[model samples]
Target chain A: MEIYNYMGYELIEKIRSKEITIQEVIQQTYERIEETEELLHSFVYLSKERALKRAKNLDAQLKNGKTTGKVLGLPIGVKDLICIKDSPTTCGSKILEEYRPPYNATVIDYLIEREGAISVGRTNMDEFAMGSSTENSSYGPTYNPWDLERVPGGSSGGSSSCVASGQTPISLGSDTGGSIRCPAAYCGIVGIKPTYGRVSRYGLVSYANSLDQIGPLGRCVYDVALILEIIAGYDPLDSTTVDIGVDEYTKELNRSIEKKTLGIPKEFFGEGLQKDVKEKVKKSINKLEGLGANVVDLSFPHLEYTIPTYYLIAMSEASSNLERYDGLRYGKMSDDLKGDVYEVFSRTRGERFGSEVRRRIILGTYTLSAGYYDMFYIKALKVRTLIKKDFQNAFEQCDAIVCPTMPTTAFKIGELVDDPLQMYLMDVLTCPVNLAGLPGLSIPCDYDNKGLPIGFQIIGNYFDEKTILNIGYQLEQELNIYRKIPPLTIRGN
Target chain B: MSKKEELSKETIEHISKLALLDLTEEEKEKLSKQLGDILNYFKKLDDLDTTNVKPTTHPIDGLKNVFREDIPGESLSNEEATKNAQHKKDGYFKAPRILKE
Candidate 1:
């Protein structure tokens, strides 16, 4: 059996039952990585030695009849933005190319200590989780496994691509405005952006503090739920985390969503949406309606303002959060420069940061600057409240909302890179969920004529991830769209 | 498109300086045009009357200042903290001199 092709949950069960040694799984994971890494360019760093060592130790523990933790030796890929102690956490930028964290992220601690999962490698991403396409990575763009010339949606493109190509059955990605869902949609995988603060951001390199979240990507909703169950909860280290008890997400995966009301926000289906994508998503919503769900036409009047509101707020926060990278502590530092402190600051930042990062910083600085504060920053914030209220009002009549994850399927690499506005619009459908701090799940609904995958997004009320996961799980069982491996993975074997 | 409003080169330079970013002459020209386009697009917000709405700085509602007990816990040693530093002196990060002699 090709163990790499098994879902994360199945692999764990197999290891727990002693059907396969943990070493065998680890070996197969690396072999799969080797098979597809050249084409996909999914990972920035691979911890083969560490993963092998941990697998061997876990194998010994199992033989000694010791009870392993929940995951029981499942290998997971982590987005490079999340720090793992002593591992390179580049966040896909040249600025911190050699920087390693002194401490692991709270999620990494939970995965290793509480759940017994091994992080196989650091997946590639947009520099500091900034762009829609992985094209912004200083390392290079991660290609979609479906078609090498096309991009894997980003900034979590590497995480989604790794899972889709069978390199790892599960991985973690951050969503700060559709980073997680976009990649999952384009790569034909399942990804969840849990409620903001549902997972700790202590180790996540912040792009925008208020909008960022760490979540899971997997081959199926069940696998995504399992990882979410292990990672979701409050952490004292992150004061923003809500002090609420985490529900057993996996327990509710098989629950029925019968008689539930799903609101299809009419604004999302309007102009610029691809015909094929719109049709596919509508069919999925219809499937839910057939499953005893009441589909209602809901309007979020503030939908058009989401891109500007989200970008203004996110960029403003990012400017503040990124002030720490001044080259004085932990990152690339310049030498042989004869300049004062201010000159050093400008030179270091200008040399190290990429064009996108510099652009956002300047824009953010201008918005928050003296003469324009109220006209730009404050106005954007007020519109943000209106956007949030739109969701609140819509949720009053529905259990969840549905939309196409992206307006269209993944485009060819470099197709939209030059046009930043076109690139920003790619997140139009996904960013509203982040703007309101709600939970969103992206699942493969159908494939386009080019064999590229189309994703359907389910947006749930704040802290209501279970309901959406339940809805996704039911649809997943019926659609069974995730069963097809990307042609690259099949060819590799 | 009617005459679009543009951000001046002076404003871009000032903002870049505030952001501690040094832009090349070419980058400044390119960025000024891009920023002008983006900000012009954002002018759509002017259409809404937000007089009664309160700005939302944080997404979560009803969050107050979280106070933790003043307790000591494990902390990073100086060496561990400075391990990634490119320039360090006497357990401190060495930065370019701020005061000119």
Candidate 2:
């Protein structure tokens, strides 16, 4: 029997009941990987032997009555940008072709060592977690399982694709200005980018430090909530992590959405939104209203400046953070090591870093350079202040803000690759959440005429993940769409 | 908005040098135009008067000086440290000479 087809919650019940062994789940997961990997290309590496051995050990422990953490026997696909000690954490860039982290990220320890969730393997991502589409990956673009020719949304695209296609029950994804949420929205699954500093960033590779956050993507909101509970909390290793404490997210999932006020940012629904996406989101808002949630339409004046503020600040930090790859200690250094230090650094980076990576680095360097520093980088930071205030003001009147995750549904693969500005525009509604360091949830709300999923984004106040989650949980119960698997999963099988 | 800022080829070369990236003419040409366009759009910020707005480098307010006890901790060992390096000499990473011989 294909026990892997079950959700994490169901799989846990069955594992506890001894109805199915962990080995059977592992076998079926590998069977699915073997079946779908060719067309989907969701994974960069598969820990087949290790997972098989681990499964046997877990099954033996269950028989021996040994303790297992929550989500025991569940399989998780981790994005390549996160470190998995001794595994190839590629960040989907050839610069780190042979690189393996010596120590597990704090999140990996929580998921694998502490929590007992099994690692299916490292998944793919954008090079250095830069792009919105997984096409920026040196491994090549991951196909959207919903539509073969379309993209799986990116940076965290592989993580989203794996769960949507049912290769793993849940996966880890990092969001630095919508990396996690964008792909989650595009792929038709549940993903959460928690309030900044909520999840420890110790093991996740840095792209933009101030904005980078580690989060989870899952087949449903409950699974995403489950992983968040496991991975969140303070860690001395990551000082940015707060000691604010994690709530019983799964338990709170049943909370009613009545009396909760949701803000509809008028600017989010303005000019660029596609007609179908707008209609579906408005209809979902009506559904929330029908469920007794109060809806308020408010104007967010500074919304137009989000892309510029997000891109400028993010790229500037990314440029500074990425200076570590000198080719001597990590990744594949350029072959022309015979030159002096400067030449070696230039040559190695020039040869190894992808086009998008290099472009951002140069632009970032310019932003921080003399004469332009105040006019560009500092101005972006000040604008970040204004944008952050915009969220603060909105949250004062609402429990959560609801909007379309993307201006449109998933586009064809390679559609916006050459046009960087057009591609950056894809994060229009999503990046503002990151700028404010607030929690954002992308849930599959409705499907367009093409059967492509449209995501409804819920932005909540700092550390108020529960309210947004309760809203998502209530909506999910109302919609009953979590069990709808993508056609590619079935077709490939 | 700031007279439509543009990046010249010389500026790209200079910044590329500072960024330690060697770029071909094609990349230089492309980045010059693309980065120019992006910077121009960023001029939109000037529209809002951020006169007294303090720059927010970190998102969470009131988090500062997260100091801990002054002590050593478990970390990557020497062998593990250089495990992914392509070249090594006597437990140290071997890199090209820093200065011209």
Candidate 3:
């Protein structure tokens, strides 16, 4: 296999044994990136010089017998929304195109300084992590590696696309209402949205503070587990993070999930779910049953309200979180001061933000406004409680909930861009997990007749990521479907 | 109260102002219609009986204000803080004049 074909954990072992130099891995990665990037459009910024320098330093340390961090010399792609000091964290928006952060996110610090991972580039995303398809990205959409004309899902589309195309073995993405899982499902890879507050949100550019979480995307379940082990922990900087022990996620990967009951949410299999997706998910459930796991039919009474509840709460939080980008402190500024302070704020934001962002902001402000607060915002919060209770009730009957990660596989570019509601519905199955603040993992199970990958989601109770990871690992071993590289990746060979 | 299902153009304009966004005429028209559709969808939440349920502002339960000792520690230097500012003057962010002198 080519060097780029090896997963991050495999590369780390090889590099540590001195069989391959970090420089060789870095060079091969960039070569693959150069070959496939134009067609995939997966990245916004490539830090070639810095990455090579870091790799050279790590290689010297390895030769000198100096101890390096756990994921030594691994190349990783980060979603543009995460702050990396001295890099242009554009968040796929034109407003912050020139803005460079002076501080790294806690997760970046853990990955680079502690884990010895080299960040290869900043991947593209939906602007402010808002849209379900990366078509909302101002830098242009990231095409699915599976099919060039299809979208790779968003707002973390670039992260998932890079992993799927073998451009990067592991990457980081933030999920706010299924940003990570949607892309992971569409691109046919492994991605997890860790339970809310399991990972710190200190440096993440907030879309919806209440729902957003930073997680890992990789080609396999173990790679996802490895990255999660490194990045998940308590951070003093983020008060919302639960002060709990971070498990060695890989330790439990080989454990059997036999006799564990899995809940199949009946609502997820109904209506908008495509037929092929349902079949693949059902087959995966049977595979689990074949592995000695039991399956039970479960119903979430409030499942229909997930989209509305999620949108209301997410938009309300986003309007408040995004109010900080008014051109005064950081983002793009207008040439003229215009009429007044209010005009400067409005004009700069109006001209800089994309239409979807503008629409959400307007909706959010309206929902939170005095006349509508009780009716929309407060009512949504109440429904959010009910959603949480629904998950709690379902978890009482099973170890985890298994469902199709998305309603369908990769949709064509420009397919749902003009229709916002249809695009929002793309997250129908995944957002319920986010709404309830549970850990959700997406791993490729089967493909449609079109040869596009379909993902099955494993959702666990609050902070119980280990259960879902173990379950996903068992199914992944049984299926063994992730080894096929996209035809675009073969072009790099 | 009667069902005020459709969002008016005036309401969208007011919302744009509140969100600190300046919308062109075409955008206003499109947004008004779109927001109305979305709001109509959100109206589904009204059917649920949430009379006694407490609103869940955050996901995790038993979350308290995490307090720490008020001890001085190293902080970001002014240069680092203002490095990304679009307009900086004399080590401070420069903004448009808000009040007349």
Task: Give me the TM-scores for chain A across all models, comma-separated.
Answer: 0.98, 0.98, 0.98
- Rank all candidate structures by their lDDT, best first, as comma-separated numbers: 3, 1, 2
lDDT of 2 by residue, A226-254 (tens): 88989999998999998897998989988
TM-score of each: 0.98, 0.98, 0.98
Q: What is the DockQ of each candidate?
A: 0.83, 0.87, 0.83
Q: In candidate 1, which residue ranges exceed 4 Å CA deviation?
A: A489-493, B1-4
Write one digit per residue (lDDT tens) for candidate 1, span A266-354: 99999999999999889998898888899889998999999989898888888887888887888886664678988898888898898
The candidates, ranked best first by DockQ, are 2, 1, 3
Candidate 3: which stretches are off by over 4 Å?
A: A489-493, B1-4
CA lDDT of A43 in candidate 2? 92
Query: How many steric overlaps does candidate 3 have?
Result: 0
Q: Highest lDDT: give the candidate number.
A: 3
TM of chain B, each:
0.90, 0.91, 0.91
Task: List where candidate 2 sits over 4 angstroms from the true fold.
Answer: A489-493
Report, to 2 decimal places, the DockQ of model 2. Answer: 0.87
